[model samples]
Target chain A: MTSRAHIAEVFMRGLYPVLIIASFWMLLRGHNAPGGGFIAGLMAVAASSAYALIFNSSKASKKMPLLPARLSVSGVLVALASGLPAVFQGLPYLSHPWWTLSLGGFKLSLSTVMLFDLGVYLAVWGAIGGICLHLIETIEENL
Target chain B: MILPVAPLLVPLGTSLLCTLTSNSVQLQRKISLLGSLLLLGTAIVLGVQVADHQSISLASGSWPLPFGIEVVVDRLGALLVFVAALMVLICTLWQMGDVDPAHSSFFYPLLHGLVAGSCAAFIAADLFNLYVWFEVALICSLGLLAQGGTLKHLDATLKYFALNLVGTLLLLTAVALLYGATGHLNFNALAMSVQYVNPAIMQAVTGLLILAFLVKAAAFPFFAWLPASYHTLPAPSLALFSALLSKIGICALIRTLSSIFHPSPEPLLSMLGIIAVLSMIVGVLGAAYHWDLRRILAFHSISQVGYMLLAMALSTRAGDAAAIFFALHHSLVKAGLFLCAAMIFKLSGHYDLRKVGGLYAEKPGLAAIFLLLALSLVGIPPFSGFWGKYLIVRECLVQGEYLWAFLALLVGALTFYSMMKIWLEAFWKPHPSAGWQAAKIVKPIPVTTGLCLLSVIILAIGLFPEPLIGFVNDAANHLRGHAP
Candidate 1:
């Protein structure tokens, strides 16, 4: 590898973490604002994938907490499970009733809809990231 | 009744769980099997409930009817869902057999995904939701078609993809146009508000939608993808594709035409009739030309779909009833015949009918099961196809469509000839390779089990078709609104 490419990789290695943190911020703030799971997930994917452009699939994949396929499927489970409470409550599925926890250390406002959004976040991150990384790796192999 | 969405959710949930458990093939397979069984259980319950009640619907997020994610299960939808779940379960069992290919590890997800999508398409109460479900099914089917990992499979996948992508695009455009013209995407809302919309816009937009569905249905001129791609799948996956995929499009057409586009669109009427007839004749003729087993069956799928489309296009109570019966009968019989073809290939070591023979002398039981399935495909007496064709022809005659009636009968004869072609070449003639007594080599227990199960279901439906007939008639009556 050239020195210029090496320098690019080092730059991306630090930038990737920042992008992921920004993605989470996007995901969390998604409920009240315009930003949501899909855009945040895309941002996260863009982060890992930029590094992958300079490196290999394995190294970039390791940056993910869960592998792409697992992340996507686990997201599905979470999303579907979020709807389960409504079934038990005899409400429509995905009713997303708010659950508030005002405790000493934590002031949390959670709902199944939030869980669903988080699931969507993880799912989008995994599926798109997987596709992008695979394509990039294919290009690298051919080169 | 409260859980109208259960039928849709079960298979999708199963598919996800299977994907999540992909680390252990055995565990994944077992989970898949359990999931399909649960799906079938849910479908059976839903079917019975819908049979009792005329219809059941649910809107997610506790939203009002028109603006929510909605699922509705009428008798027809419930029946199709039951059949889809059954096919998935059978295919799951068949895949567990020793006949599976090396790369079949992906089969679980694809099968459940396809089933889930079909179920969702059947029950989706809104146009955009239906499109989303159809895409899910389409993507999963393409995955199955391409999983063979060969150049030929890639070629087939591209063909299927290209055609389906156009259909999907057209569908999206139509939906967007309709929603923009009238601010409703729900079927009931659209149906109510469509009359107030401009006739020109309705005609053009609904025309596009019907044409899009026709492509998805593999109606004439859009059917090339089916024969090209379906031949690449293994038997289990092929059976599910043959059984459920096109039927969803037919059902969608029936739903939209009968409900939303009541009285039918002006110019599209005769055009749909001509397309149906062409599909019938062209499909059987293509089947006549193919010696490969899957290609022949693939072509026949187009023909059978034609029958259902014709009946549905009639837009009468009896016609809808006949269409529903035809869809149900054809799903069972076609899947049975495809499974039997797989067994023949297992016993004879070839899919080409020209190269294989002597099954009648060696394995009479196999020959007999094939005969029942083939005969059903041919619309013979004492089988479900017989009634399916009879109702279609009778409905055509009643509609003063003499030419369509005659052509349907002609296609039946042609279908018979194709079945005979398979029978003579694969079952009757002497084995091309002498001293190759291949009958005793392998029994294919799993395949024969599937074949027998399908045949018995066909036989039971054939013998006791009164219940199905009544149910479909009721479904048709319900679709026709309060005047039944």
Candidate 2:
């Protein structure tokens, strides 16, 4: 039988990655329907916060020492990338195409604009959560 | 084929470069300077184009108009963006070595992003597009405000966010309703169809839209969040926030008010005029009451905005022109003054007027800078501030707006009084016990030479107002449906 602490560790270890995956899914699907960058980022950060609470802050820091900022910048890049083609074509920024994807027995349509939303989600989650954790650590050190 | 998207790219690209590199503070400073220099160049070229052409719109993918998102640039938009860029550039220089290294590192990117967002907002043609750019600019300001993450900063940032959130939601609802009522999102398109819409619904949207902008600009009843939270921000952040972020609301208000709600027989014009006068009185009073230098300046920002609103409310060609000209003037002067105030705080490690003394005795250059900026603020002759007032009073008189003219003069006098208080206490007073000991200070008095130099530029603009004013007049005329 798994001990209580072991079960807890398993839960702790698995939780963030699962949350990250869920967040990515949400962001990707958010374009036409719902679940855009803002919500997904919040969810991803919530998972990160939970992980920090259960595991040692250090471990969580190690695993995700530099987030939010990193993600936010990447998200901006994703947005710019999607938007650049339009600019090169002599169009306004962020006025580009919607994307679509297909796999066996399933078809999905994707928007580059949706990718932009996902980028925002990742960026916010990473930047805000990372910064908050870092600040908390600083306060903890003083304490 | 239309508006140059390059100004937005120039900043966004620079932000990306700065954020990705882990660099020394000095390196970051250089990056900011370089980026701003490029932006200044880009702004100049774009300004020329915009001045000549009047208005230009760009749609991505060569998409046809009315079917695609468009970036539209007019003379007023170009002028404000250029002013914002220049002030940020100068403020960056003044802040060198004063702010924390980590803060400095991120400051450039955030600053540029704010510029990009502001530029985008100025030129955006669609309502939803305006909303997105507004959020982008707001986030940039919020990020700067949240620097160092002190309890005070967090609280202020939260309050700012909450007010802006509610304001934005209301704005979004108005946008949705506007689209539903007219099946149009473009400003020009909406303007054409607005006459067909029911008056009641149009008035409702106008009220909601104006409320959103008023809250952002901190006019009258919406002014509380500004003073309460703005004082807590670091000087550099505050300088930018007070100068650039506030103007976004003014621009949006001017853009929408004239285009969408013009000629409406609603009684709201008088209400706006009353709010303008009240904001001037209350803001000046708040300044008179505050001994904290930053708080004083923050209060004056509210007062300055009132004059702009007063001009807009006059609903005359000259009034509109004067308001636009003054908006540009205020952006430059206010940014310079805040930079000067930040320099003072940096030098003394105190924001209280009571504690500050003998700055002129110690730092002659800084005192001179303060004097020049204060002169500009108080509407002294041969300065940009004076020309702004001259234009407004002249326009008000021409329009038979004698009451507004009187209020303008009153506000100017009160502004002079408040500014003189800072001048006397900080620059003229005898050194009190334990007065400014420059040698014992932790950080060297952050050199405001760059910002002072920028003030000189404003003086230049004031002295030689032909080119800029010509451009502004062109914009004003364009808005009035005249030839550029």
Candidate 3:
């Protein structure tokens, strides 16, 4: 199931880089803005799905950096662990504890809530991507 | 403070852990069992705490009520959670022997996921959060249902998934409409705001909500999916599904009816009453016709749900108490019966009574336990089911709902007939085939011990029901928006 359209492959190659950067932008700005983990995760899924479509799903899956199941599991663990400090502090579960750091005169704010969001990001990306890949493979096999 | 969220945290954390260690079958089982025990412990402690405190509510992220998700553990919620946790532990023990090791990696995590979702559903104080939990439970159950990946499993899962997705959509629509109408989604907030909403609109929203919940609860008109899909799975999964899944729907119905729409419109109440009677009759008739053990039990689950809905229809404190008591009793008796049925399947290699027999002669202990559980389910005296049914009948009679009371009694007798059919065919009749002789007993000890433990609990509750009755009364009072 190799790509037969060179234009389609070229288009995907150009689109994916932009999509990945947009997804990161969405994730980083999600906390107080309109975009969030879910939308950003969808963005990432879109990029990969497009790439798979042009390059053939089997080859893309072979070259994938991480197995979707492992990614999703780790994501869930990270999300769950993000809540532990609150329990230790005698607060309600999932209560966020925030911190601010200045590195090289650049200020950054971090919190358990961000970690939770990041976890959701990874989870959604992996879950939907895995499902898409599976469906594509099944379709290919049937064809 | 910690108690309010312990039930949720234990299961969620365990599920994630299980998922992480899915490669190791032994480790997955150990973690899952340990997590279930911890969940049970937390549930018991939470129940006691709620009993003493009247009700416990916690808002996640310290967000104030009406703005953030709330988890409230009142007497009834705590009781249901505790029972669910117990069932989870027992089912996990049964799973040790029942589940194929190849499937354990998926089974353990999904089981814990289901537990977490059910616990969340029981305690959720917001309409949207309840929907979320319902979906969570549905997703996990769907995964578990499809774990075998056989043609039959896939078929059942597809049907179950499709119907449940429709129900979920309906529920979400109702939640959206309610939020639009009342501008509040939290149970407490809705209770206060609902009174001000226009009556016609409120009724419309209530109808939508009831329809969604009834579908989930497997009431008469929408119950076809239950019997079709439930009997297709393994016995341990069936046991869990029987014990907790539909009951969550019942819990949601009771909570919604009592908290948000108490003194439910008389017409709606009567409508529900008629539906309840139809469910009872249809469910029992279906059970009587089916010869398969699990199918008969599945049909009975529908009929038993009818009894609870009947109590809900009464809309009185006594009715509420009876409903709660009946729900608790039904979960225990039904789970025990399903586990027994599992053992029978193992011993006889057939769920069909026509092909299986002589259980009494082969395993008299199992036969006796099944008899006791069946009798309890039939509402025999000195069994826990009797008190629940008696209370409902009494409440109906006192409320002058004689027709409902009579129908409930009639259903009880039919339930008896169906249970007797199983007893007569499987236990009393001669063995139909040599399969019983060749059937291997797998992990008989854990399975038997779990069944016996549940049976003892049933008998203990039967013998001394005053404490539970008192608890239900308190729960009823709370549901009535009164201080206990």
Candidate 4:
């Protein structure tokens, strides 16, 4: 029993990094392809849900660390934060900011609008997951 | 930037706060109210600024146009934002004391989020961004409507969910096709690329998008889901939903067709004309026979939307302006009437016109408020509603569409009868049952007072509409591509 629990814990820990990477990749490719914030968020939430089911939810939640509730809030904050500079720039809100930084061999362009999309992905994932978690906890208590 | 974007963000930020503190009802209400006030203030400030300066657009993250979601603050979008914000704030206040603190708190955040989402939908330049906003609004609405966890409420919400999903899916399909055809989702880019696309594909895309929007707006053949779900929600929630949510669909339709597709005047205009006449007639007829006060009001919401669509269908400057004005007028009047109905429910414990009577004797102030709102609904002069209907009919007459103009006027008369039916049954007649007399009446709270004041503002606007008309004309000119 102990071994089984330990293995599940290890597997859950390993899953987060992969989920996080996959979400970013999806978001980056979204503008041109079918992969966007909504789908990427679904990916993140699906991974979290999987972890919760494999390990104890309490452990899975602690491993995830950020409460889905807080993440939900912060995701919106990040989205708004990305748009705030535009407000100061005398433009409308959520004005995407872009500056291209050239590396020795590669060009990396950072986009506030892209960041906003990531925020949306995280927020949706966290929100839906958090609500589901809360409901599950309540149902378990009642049972 | 002082654009529609900030208004969208305010509620989204507050929604997060609400979710975090979902455990505390009182905390939620305060936060919600504060959030709503912020949005309302932002909208007013932006409206003034835009009225002075003209249209504004902020590209998120400084991405160049056609690359990122562009938040627009043209005259039309800003005005709708102002009206939506006002409705949300009033509905929030009206429900404040009446709702359980916990529920009320939950209610406000979601309501704010819904408003923000709708505002975003109205101004979004990118199709994908529009989808995101639509989802946010939809999820929040589902949460608000299902808050009670009652079987009936859940059932109603589930149906709403199913219908919304289908509508959204249709929207998604249209977006996919548009992207496939042009490899661009931005409205401006798509419009430029549309002429290059095959005629058959363009027609399909237009049909799909229109169908999706019609379903969302609850137009004649597509309106069943609205009445079905609305009848089951708490009064305040239903009022907000009716007043705001459906408008998102109409907004999207207007933006897509007017800005992107830019369809010719012949087929599209005639089809919309037929749709408007059918919707107006059917909606009014539905309201006339309904004995339940809430359902009657809900049905009229559909009818009023038809009036707005009639103007939109014309696709002229006068048409768009009237659509915008009518949308604002209907949102305020409908919201006020629904909240009034909610208050009456508290006093009489029944919403059926047949059972609810003598309300005026017990709650004269409330009854009077409802009377004023209903009058606005029927387009009485010195009210905002009058301006919208008059402008549209006047334009129709000028265009030599005498038959549509006459039908439009007839719809107004029918609307008055529907309003009168409610007044006579729910307010004038003596209580038919002993239970009504025994029902306890609650006095208006400060929040309720705020709501009433908001309604008065609508009256004020009607009494002095010159400035608003000027703004509308400016907005119309911008929409007509007369201004860059």
| Top candidate, metric lDDT | 1
Model 2 chain B: worst 10 consecutive residues (lDDT sum): B439-448
User: Which candidate, 3 or 4, would have the higher DockQ against the true structure?
Assistant: 3
Model 4 misplaced regions, further than 4 Å: A1-55, A62-66, A82-143, B1-4, B99-105, B263-265, B434-443
Sorted by TM-score (best first), the order is 1, 3, 4, 2
Per-residue error for B178 in candidate 1, Å, reads 1.3
lDDT of 2 by residue, B1-484 (tens): 3246666777787787678764666666777788888888877878888876877767755567676777777888788878877866766765664532225467778887888888788878788889898999989888877876889989988998888888789889989988888898888788788889999998888878888888888899788778878778766667777777778888888877776566644477778888889998999999999999889998999999999888888776667777888888888788777767766776676789998777887778878877888888788887888888888888889878799899999999999999999999987886565634743434444444566566788789778877767777677777666311
Name the TM-score of candidate 4. 0.86
lDDT of each residue in B1-484, candidate 4, tens digit only: 4455677777778777877787887787688788878888988888888887877777765577788777777877888788777776666676566532225446767777788788888778788898989988899899887888889989988888998898999989999998999999987798789989998888888888888888888887788888878877776677678778888888887776566777643576688789888999999999998988878988898888888888888887778778877877787788778777777677777888777888888878777888889888898987888898899999888888899899989999999998999888888888987655635534457546755775777889789988877787777777667422
The positional error of residue B214 in candidate 3, measured at the CA in angstroms, is 1.0
Better of 1 and 4 by DockQ: 1
Candidate 2 or 4, higher DockQ?
A: 4
Q: What fraction of the reference structure's interface contacts does model 2 contain?
A: 0.44
Model 3 ranges with Cα > 4 A deviation: A1-26, A31-35, A50-65, A102-106, A136-143, B98-104, B433-438
| Candidates 1 onward: DockQ, in order | 0.60, 0.30, 0.61, 0.45
Pairs that collide, model 1: none
Scoring model 1 with DockQ, what do you get?
A: 0.60
The full ranking of all candidates by lDDT, starting with the best, is: 1, 3, 4, 2
Pairs in steric clash, model 3: none
Please give each candidate's TM-score. Answer: 0.95, 0.83, 0.93, 0.86
Per-model CA lDDT versus the true structure: 0.87, 0.77, 0.86, 0.78
